[model samples]
Structure formats: structure tokens, C-alpha cells
Target chain A: MKRKVFVASSIAAALAGCAKITNGLNEWQPAQPILNSAETLNQAIIGTRGTARLYRPGDVTLDYPVNSLDTPHQPEYLSLIESDFTTYRLPVGGLVDHPQTFTLRQLRALATLDQITRHDCVEGWSVVGAWRGLSLGSFLKLVRPKPEARYVVFYSYDHDQSGQQFYGSLNMAQAVHPQTMLALDLNGKPIDAAHGAPVRLRVPTQLGYKSTKWIRNIALVSNFKDIFGGQGGYWEDAGYAWYAGI
Target chain B: MDATAGSSAPLPRARSSEAGVVVRRHSLVTRTTHWVVFIAMIVLTMSGLQIFNAAPYLDASDKSDPARRVLSLDGRTTPAGSVGVTTILGHELTTTHLLGYTDDGQGGETARGFPGWITFPGYQDLAGGRRWHFFFGWVLVLAGAVYLIWGIGRGELSLLILRPSDLPKLWPMQAYYLRLRKEPPDHGKYNPLQKAGYTLVLFVLTPFVIVTGLVLAPGFDAVAQPIVWLLGGRQFARTWHFVAMLAFIGFFFGHVFLVVATGFVNNMRSMILGTYRLGKHEGTGP
Candidate 1:
């Protein structure tokens, strides 16, 4: 009886350990912050001021894969798409000194930059395409964000099977990076529905997921602690790296 | 029949004639790092396969093209049913129930790059895979760093480093393994072939895998761009990473075979307990 009990307890303890490990697989740990910081520092060490033209134009993949293509049938998104996104207004609010809601036309009127860059997906595929839009740095200058605003959160209309909406955010350094853009056009044409039509966050220096699509709201926030899932982005909430520079 | 002159350093003469004497074979640090690296590699390799399932293709250029792809896994539907296909170097193979399609750890079969049994978590979870991969990746790097520093500081690296003079003894060692020679020539501490294998894995394959992996990281791209260019490009680096993984797997199998063939119990004891019972003969190994 003693030996049997000991064996039973050992099996139970092993099962408990396995459960803990599985649960901790996606658990938010303190080391993530340190890792993110280290990654950011590595980028800085390489002097990637985001000015370097990385990919050649000839290498651009004309037929870029459209990810997160499942459009939410939300009423707001449906109405916006019906209007051809013409009446769409991007509200930039929260920790910014000057709150503004710019129409697509107004966004187009801002200082725009067109560059052919590589889009590296986290899944190990790379696609090169030309993106035309206002440089996020120039757009930030116009918005005049408060010094306390450390992150720019872009809200999307897409969601997962669990009905959780898709969203992503970038730190102030990444938000103001020269290659970061609020893209209005892809492949020298107006953005199509499959590719985040009205506006998309195009961050060439990071993974493709960091570049959110169908951006409806832009909020400057001090931190992402109170945000949905509190992990900075949909994929990040699902346990991907928030920095995503890799 | 006798020890090769061009082999490594001289071995200590056995003091016993019957029951072999026990001797210290490994340091505490060596044993610790060896086990740590062994565990970390298993986790990294499985999780890496899980991550690879996300794209299931290896390209040779900056962008993925059908023509330039080195390896690809795809699914197809025929009148018979859906079948998983794996293509490599222009040759196609139906890898149904395995490579391109397999169980999802649930009863249901799914289309994936590698089989579920071989993947970490044994399901489709790229996000989870990346988390496991990065965490263990750091563990491997730290363990590797400790081992490297300790090896260099203690001059243990010389035991694995092959010299020009050791080349002649490699064939004799191979012949011993093939049973073409009756007695294994003494090669002190490590045989010439063992030295060559360890040197290739430590100094060549491991570093190549690491550099290629670093090249895949976008944050490190700026610094690693020149290295990437020298190796062809980003996609080539990615392909080479997978190739290096295969080579590591091959080395692992060969290493295990040798451990078992030469002296399983003694070798295991030496690695685990830091001590080995030497054979009656002075030149006999652990």
C-alpha cells in the first residue's frame, strides 16, 4: 500500500508539472520586457535609422499574399466598405496634443513617400512591394503627440474565431521610424479590399504582422497595460513577440 | 595493433591488470553544459519544425518563386483524396500521412509541414512554437557560451581540434569501425575521427547554423547583411539553416551509434557521473 501510494503521488506530481509547463507556455513573463529591450538595442547598434533602401524595385512580388484576409462582417466595417471608404475618417485621439480626424483625402494631401521594400512574414516568406503613403514620422509631427505618449495603437476591424478584434501597436521609436508609413497605396494603385483598403500600418523594418491592416483608430497611449488582452497586439496577445523586429 | 604515432597525446598507462581502474573522465561544467545543450537542442529542433509548418517552403531567392524554391510542402486533392506532397530539388514525393499531412494530436489529420509527433506541442500553433523556440534558443546560446568559455579557458577545445598530423590516423579509425582492422588503434582521449567530427560540428556546422539563424532575424539584418550576401541572400540563408539542421541530426545519430558501439555503459557513466572504468589494456577507451 505504501509503494502504491508513492507511485500514485509521483504520477500525479508529474501530471501537475506538465500542466504547469503547458499553462506557462503562453504566460506573460517579466523576461519579455528585457528581451524586447535587448532586441531594440541590437537594432540601434546596427545604426538602422530606417533610411536604408533595402530591396530592389525589380524584386517586388506583384502578387503579394493577403494575410488576415478574413474580413469581419461587423456592421461598421460593412457600411464603410459600402461607401468605398470615401467617407472613412481616421480619428487620432488620446495622449496627443492636437486631436484630429483626417479623411482619406486629407491623409493623401500630407507629405507622402513611395518606396519599394521587402515584407518579411513571420512564417519565413518575403514579398517585396511598393508602398505609397505619409511617412509615420511626418504624420506624427503633424499630430504633435504628447511627450508621455510612448506607443501608437492601431485598431483594426478584423477579429479571430473567438470574436476578439485584431489590433497592433508600436513603440514611439518604431512609430516614428522613417520607414514606418500609414500606407494609402500598394503597387502604385489605391489599396484594395484584400490588402487593408483604406489605410494600413506599413512597418518595413518589422515583421508583416506588426503592420496592421484596415486601421480605423489611431490612439497615442502611455502604455498598453489596460488595452485588450494587454499584450500590445492580437498576435502578441496570442504569444508572439510584440517587438517583432525578428 | 599498436597506437598510431601521429594520433593525439599519449594516454595514461593502466595500473590494473584485471578489473579496470576508475578514472575521472569529465568535469562538472562539461557534464552540465552537455546535458543542457542536449535538452535545449531537442526543444529547439521540435519547435523549429513547428514554426517551419507555418510556411512549409524554402526559397532560394529574396522572394519565394516556384522555380527557385529548394524545398516545398503542399497539399493536393485528387479523386482518391487529399494527399500531402513534398518537393525537393525539382523532385516531387507524395508524403501522405507524414510530412505535408498528419495527425494534429487530435484524432483528426491535418495539413502540416512536419508530423505532429515530431513537433513541439504536437499541434498547429506558430505563436506558441515561436515562444518555445525563442525561450530555448536563449537557453542554448547561454549554455553554448558557458561551454565555449570553459573549454577555451581550460584548453579542453584542443581535445576536439584536429591537426594536420591527425589526418593520417582518421582512416585507421574508420577501418576499425568497419571491422577491416581487428584492433582499434589508440588515439589518446579521443580518436582522430572523433576529433574531426567534433571539430566540424563545433567550429563549422554550429557556427554556420547560428549565423544563418541570426540572418533570419530582421533586427539583426543590418549587421548580418554582409554575411547574408556572402552566403547568397536571405532566402539562401534560410535554406542553409534547414540544411544545417539535417546535418546536425545526422551527426547526432552517428554520435549515438558510436557511443553505443564503443562502450555504452562506460560512456554513459563518464558523461553522467564524470568517471569511467578504464579497460584492462592501457589504450582501451571508456
Candidate 2:
């Protein structure tokens, strides 16, 4: 009886001491920043110059899987869908010389680019998609981001079950890449609710989650430390690497 | 009889003593690399399986299609309860309590491609699995490189690599193992089967697995599109990666079996202490 009690006490003490460690198995911070190093090495060796090359038009794939389609805030999505996104205004501000609010029509009127590219998901699946939109580089040129801006934070209408808004960010180099765009169309069709209607960021270089959908705001910031969860992106906060080049 | 069994054949290469003949079997490099690889491979394989559970499907085309799934783990409902179903090449098999849905580590069943016990962290966390996989992946590569460099420089690979002369001795070794022959054949440090198995793993399977692994990385694929194309795309690479993992697992079972069967103490001593004893009651036969 005494030994059993001692074992129980030890177990309790160990659990108490390792509260953070025991909460989640894969939640601990890495000793070495492998993801960051991999991203740097990938960039250096590939010589992509921050650009993930486009695919040929013939390679455009129609079948695509929609993941994390529903949002916790259904009313917000319903209102956007009800108004056909006409009332939607994408506010681009923070560390920019000229902050601008762009409507769907206004975004469409900007210099357009169409490219087919592969979307590699972190879940080990992939799809080739043809996207049409204005290059984010062209839009960033208009916004005139301040030299202090180091990252571009994208806030979207969608939220997880916990009501946390879906958000992601990109380094300045990737933000201004020619291939990165605020995509409006997919496969010659207007973006649907199932696929982040109105506008979504298309970052072919990075994993799928980085290409955030239903974008509501774009903020240029020096750091994402003050953002929600303070991990650059919602998924990044949930243990995914911020730089998912692999 | 056992003492005089090999008198007519070639004498074993060892220093004979009263009890037995002791031979220096492994070098420090070989033993160190072997253990390092063993640990790294365990971590790599478990974490890799965890990563695979994220998608749990294999395909050949660049774009994934539900219909073209070559392998998948999913759930099924029956009157008894929910069960796991594993589908391979359009053939379905009920693999309940093993895959698709299994113990959630809290005395409950949860849906997952692979079970919790076999996976690292005992939970489904792709990011965590990825971190562990990549970390050990580098360790494995570095260790393999060291072994390769040392093996080549010291001409140690000749023992592991099967030469044209080793081919003819394979059947005899097989016969000895199967007890079709009364006596084991005269051999050098490694038998013919050992040379073949080691050669296949060290040269063919490991390199193929590594190449396919690189292809699965989008960043690498972006740079080496031509090479990826030759491999038939990332999805194809993923399929082959799983196949290679299965092959490695099979090889591991066979390796352990041989180690245990052919005088477990002596084999372990050779690997760990760099010495092996050859005498009566050592292995299957004289």
C-alpha cells in the first residue's frame, strides 16, 4: 500500500512538472530551426529567385480537394456570399506609404496574370490548378510598402472551430514574387464559396495552407509577433513550420 | 566429429584456442555505423509512417484523385461497431483494431491511417512527425556517407558487395540453412546470402528510397523537375517510397532472424565487441 501510494505521488509530480511537455507530443519548440534552414537552402540551391515556376496550361488539373472549407463564423461567410462579395473591401495597410481598400471589381481591373501551377498540400497530396489574378507584386507596388515592412500578413474571413480567424504571412521576398497573386478566378470560373470566393492569395511556392482564402485584409508588418497566436500563421501556431518550402 | 568436420576443407580464418576459434569480425567503423543507422532508421520509419497517415493514399499522377488511389485506410460501419478498412489496389480488407481506426492512447478508438503505438509521439501530428523525420534523415545521410567513404577508402565494400565469384556459393549456403546439406560450406568472413542482402540494401534500396524521398519534397521537385519527371512525378515517388519502406522492414525481419538463428550470442558479440567465436554448437551445423 505504501509503495502504491509512492508510485502514484511520483506520477502526479512528474505530470505536474511536465505540464507543458505533456499537453501535446509534437508541440515542443525545436532546438534547431530545421524548417528555416531548409527554406534557405532550398532557395539557394534551386535558384528559383523566390519564384516557383508556373506549369503549362495543358497540365491544368480540374479535380481539387477543398479542405477546411467551413468557418466557425458562418454568419460572416453567409453575408459575404449573400452580397456576392460586392460590399467586401480588402483593406491593405500597415507599414505601407499608401494604404488602400480594394473591392472585387477594383482588384479585377488591375494588371492581370494567368498561370497554371501545382498546389502541394502539407497533407502529402497535390493538385495542379490554373489561377487568374493580378500579381501581388503589381499590387504591392501600388500600395508602396514601406522599407521597414518585412512580412505581409493576410487576414481572412474564415475561422477554425475555436473562432480564431484564418491568417497567414509571407516574407517580403515571397510577397513581391511575380508568381504570387491575389487570385480571383480558378479554371476560367469565378471563385466559389467552397474555394475561397472573391479573392485568395495564390502562393505556388509554399504549401497549400500558406495560400490563404477569403482574404479580408492585407497588412505589411515588420514582425508577426503581435498577431493572433504570434506564430506568423494560424497553422504555424498549431505546430506547422512558418517556412514550408518542403 | 564437429572438431574434425572442417579439417578436410579450408581452415576457418581465426586464432584457434582451447574452447573455440576467435575471429575479429567487425571494425569500429562498421559497428558504430550499424548502431547509428539502426536507431536513425527506427525514428525515420516511425515518423515517416506518421507522415504517411496524413494522406494515407498512394497515386502515380502529380494530381491526386480519389478514384486512382492505390492504397488507402478508411473506416467502415457495421452492426457490431465502427471498424477500420484498408484498401489496396481496389481490393478491400477489414483491418479493425490495427489501422484506419485504433486506440487513441486514452482507452478509446480514433480514426487514423496508422495506429498510435507504432507512430512517434503516439499521436497524429504531421508537423511533429516531419520535424523528427527531417532531423533523423540528416543523421542517417551523414552516417551513411561516413560508412560509404570509409568502406570505399579501406576496400571494405568488397566483403559486403557480391562479386561474380560469390554467385555460385549461394545455393550451397541456402542448402545449409534449409538443412538440405549435412555440412555448411567453406566461406570467408561473410556468406554469399549476407553479401547479396547487404549489397541490395546498401546500394539499391537505400539510394532508391533516398531519391524518392527527395522527389516528394516540393522544393526539391521544383528544382529537379526533369528528374522528377523521369521518376513519373511526386505521387509515383510516394508510392515507391512506401514500397521501399516495406522492403526495408522485410529485410529487417530477415536480418534479425538470421542473427538469432546463427548463434545469437556470437553474432551480437561480433557486432558489439568486434569479435566472433567459431566452434562446436555455434550455429546450425558443422
Candidate 3:
């Protein structure tokens, strides 16, 4: 009986300690706020909670607009993408031996492959689509990264109202995975504007966001800690996990 | 053989209260089975979380274009003839496109079956989900069967199954727990709360998760109607599944809390080694 009392008291003390640690971590506010403040945290939390309020409990609606060559052209639905060999320039900088620029043509000149894969969303939706592009490994080889380089960060053109760019990072292992590709085509034909074209990324093992859509620049960094939001990606800085691998 | 057996009998009986603790408690087989169940639960939880992640959503906006361009099917680059070949930062390259399509007000053709491009299965992908869940379930059921049989043979079930005397004791236990007054009761083997938890998990939660999962199986539309009706139609089943999942999550966390609270070392040793060192006056308290 005395032993049981001791055990119970010890357990109570442990639980109290755990509760204090959790509460403190949650309440601690960083000196420099990057994304949403505590006030907006509630709103963001509400938006995420809305996921449970799905119209169809298990069903998901793919709201992205789809297009085909056979469909009649609607002027309003006309492509928003503007393309010219000269207009498309990829800026590669940060911790590199040579800072160079590559147009759409240069990227296409390399070997390419077409792959069919699924995009699994965290909200519990999945869709399969064919993607065609050059291997990301091939591009990484061309860069000939410095010995100090530890992470490769992708900067995108798409952004929220804050002018913050959509970004993602890859460790050396995943960056060099043979399956990772910089895709330019969908299905059997070229990618439509609705889909990321010119060049988008395809990382089969990760979620949809890990595969960034629009490509505008690339940066090699020693560490991800100094980056904006300090969490690696735009959404990650807000609250998302950096490693979204399945 | 008879002489050896006779000699060992007196030896065990002589030390029954000292060296042979199993004489007054669980048999070796029952203790082993209980430990197996404990280990299985831990493995299932860890590996299952790795398969489908829900926590810690990533923010992709701050990343560079190459890092951000992880995957895309839409053509957004400029036409080949318009842009020049230029490297941005020695290594990174960007290409614009002309073939990008805009999503006007009209929704496009609904693709049938699964899309051919993406490989990750979603939560709604009943086919894939069922495959993994059922495979794991068979293992769980087999383990549970062995446990049930051993428990019955060893009279371990008596400790687990609630008795009439447990009814009134629950209120006082609850009060004790809420007020943090004292150790609730001296449980012979399993406490009232432990019995209730194990019962619900075995007879209620597991069955619900499995049956509802089967009902949502893909390409099995033949039984869909009957199953739906049994669950009070599709909507009700879906709602039930969601609610049941929440309850299971709650139970899982509560189970962990109990393990942590009830002497982690002793609990772990009991479940792993099948040897529980009952303290002096262990079952004497109220």
C-alpha cells in the first residue's frame, strides 16, 4: 500500500512537470515575428479546423480548372502565361562558383523523362497525373555545388499578398534522388498554363507542396536557419513541417 | 519421471510466497501474451504515423524557384522562341512558357478512376487505406486470440472482467482521481478504469474502425448499399467513422498517459519481461 502511494505521487509530479513544459513552449513568443501574429494564429487555426468540415466527409473536390485541346476556347479562360525564350530566365545565385542564367530552351536541351505519379494533399485528397521533365539530379551536377553547400533552396514566383515567395528545400540525399525531375510536360503533351509549365519540380515521395509549381530562382545555402520565417517554406514558416516526405 | 515431478512440486510450494510469485498471480503464458500486446501497440502507432503525416504542414512560399518547383503539370513557361538561354546563379535556371492554361469559370472534364500522375494515396483512397489497415488488423486479431485463450486458461480474465462490486466503486475512484486525493483503489490485477478501457478497445473501438473501414472499400459497390443501410446510410457511416476515429485518438492518448502515470519502469518491466514485482501491501489499499 505504501509503495502504491509513492508510485501515484511520483506520477502526479511527472504529469505536472510535463504540463508546465508544454504550456511554456506554447506561450513563448519570438522576438522577431516573421509570418502571422498571435492574433492571426486563431484565424489560421480556424482555417485549418475547416478541413474537418469537408462538404463530403471522405470525398474531396479538385477545384483546379482543367483544360484540353478539344475544348472550345473561352476568351476569359485564355492562358495567363506569357512565354518567349528571352523572357524566361532562371537566376542561380548564392554560394556558387559561377553565377549563370538558363532559359527554357537550355533546360529542354537536356535529357528528359515522362513519369506518371500521384499528388497526395495533407487535407486527404489525391490525384494522379503524368509529368515530363529533365532530371533534377542532372541540374545539380551541372551546378557543381561547393563543398560547404549543405542545402539547396528553390525560390518560386508565386506568392501571397505579403510578397513572400513560395519556397522549399532538399537535403543532399533527396536532392540527388534519381526520381526527382524538373518537369515541363503533363500527360502526353506539354503542360498547360493551369499546371506549372516551362519547368516545375516532381518529387514523388513527398506531398504536393514539396513539389513547387513556378520556378524563378535557385539558391545554395549552408543552413536553412537564416532564411525568412526560418522554417524553410512559406507555409512551413506559418506552421507546416519542413520534411513533408511520406 | 514421477519421482522428479513429485520432488519439484514440494520445492515450488515451499517457496510459493517468495521465489515463486507466479503461484498467486498470472501464469507464464498469460504474462507473455500481455507483453506481446503492449509491444504491438507501440510498433503500430510509430510506423502508422510515418506512413501518413497530418501534423506540421510546410510553408513553401519563402523557398527559391528551383526549391519551390518540386512538381508541376501546368505549362506556365514562355514559348521556346521568345526566351534566351541564361543561367541565373551559375547553377539555377528558369524557363517561362506560353502554353499555360487559365481556369475560366467552367469546370473541366471529371477524370474517372484514379489520376495517372500522382502516386501518393489520399485519406479518401479507400482501396489503399483498406489494404494496409486490413493487413495490420489480421496481425492484431491473431495476437488478441492468443491473449484471450491464455487469459482464460490462467484465470487472468477474472482480473480483467468487471464484477458487480465495481459499479459503486467507480464513482469514488472518479472523485479520488479528480480531486487528486489518493491512490484510487487496490486493484487485484486490472483496475476498474483499465478494465473499462480494454473492454471498449476490444469490443467497441476495434470493431467499429474495421467495419466502417470495410464499408468504405473501393470497387466493392455490390455490398455498399447493404453496408450503408446497416450503418444508417452512407452519411451516417462517414460521420460515425470520423467520430470513432476521434474517440480512438482520445483513448490512445489516455492509454499512454496511464502508462506514464502508473510507474513507467514497473509497467514497462511487467509488460516486457512478464515479471511484475508486486510491492508489499500492493493490493491492500482501498
Q: Considering every candidate listed, which one attains the maximal DockQ?
A: 1
Candidate 2: segments with Cα more than 4 A from true spot: A1-63, A69-77, B1-21, B181-187, B278-286
Alpha carbon lDDT at B147, candidate 3: 74
Q: Which ten residues in a row have the lowest lDDT in candidate 2 chain A?
A: A15-24
- Give residue B6's lDDT in candidate 2 (0 to 100): 24
- Residue A96, model 1: lDDT of 90
Q: Give lDDT tens digits, candidate 3, residues A1-246.
A: 999999987965564453344233223455124212322332222211101111221222233323211221223222324333246677777777876788877877874766665444533234456667887777877777787877778876566555566688876655676667788876655655556655667675554666776666888888889898887776567654455442
Q: Which of the numbered candidates is closest to the native, going by highest TM-score?
A: 1
Ranking by TM-score: 1, 2, 3
> For candidate 1, what is the DockQ-based docking class?
acceptable
Per-residue CA lDDT of model 2 for A167-241, tens digit only, reads: 999988778778888999998998787888889988887788889998989999999999988989988898777
Count clashing pairs, candidate 2.
0
Per-residue lDDT of candidate 1, residues B121-149 (tens digit): 56677877776777677777788899889
TM-score of chain B of each: 0.89, 0.88, 0.55
Model 1 — interface RMS deviation?
4.6
Q: How far is candidate 2 from the true structure (C-alpha RMSD, Å)?
A: 7.3
State the lDDT of candidate 1 residue by residue for A1-246, as single tens digits.
Answer: 999999987965554454344434435476455434544444455433434236767777889888774866788888988998888999999899899999988998983788887777899887888889989988987779999999999999887777888999998888888888999998888888789988999887788999999998999999999999999999888778776877
Candidate 1 residue pairs in clash (backbone atoms < 3 Å)? none
Query: Candidate 1 or 2, higher lDDT?
Result: 2
Q: Report lDDT per candidate.
A: 0.78, 0.78, 0.49
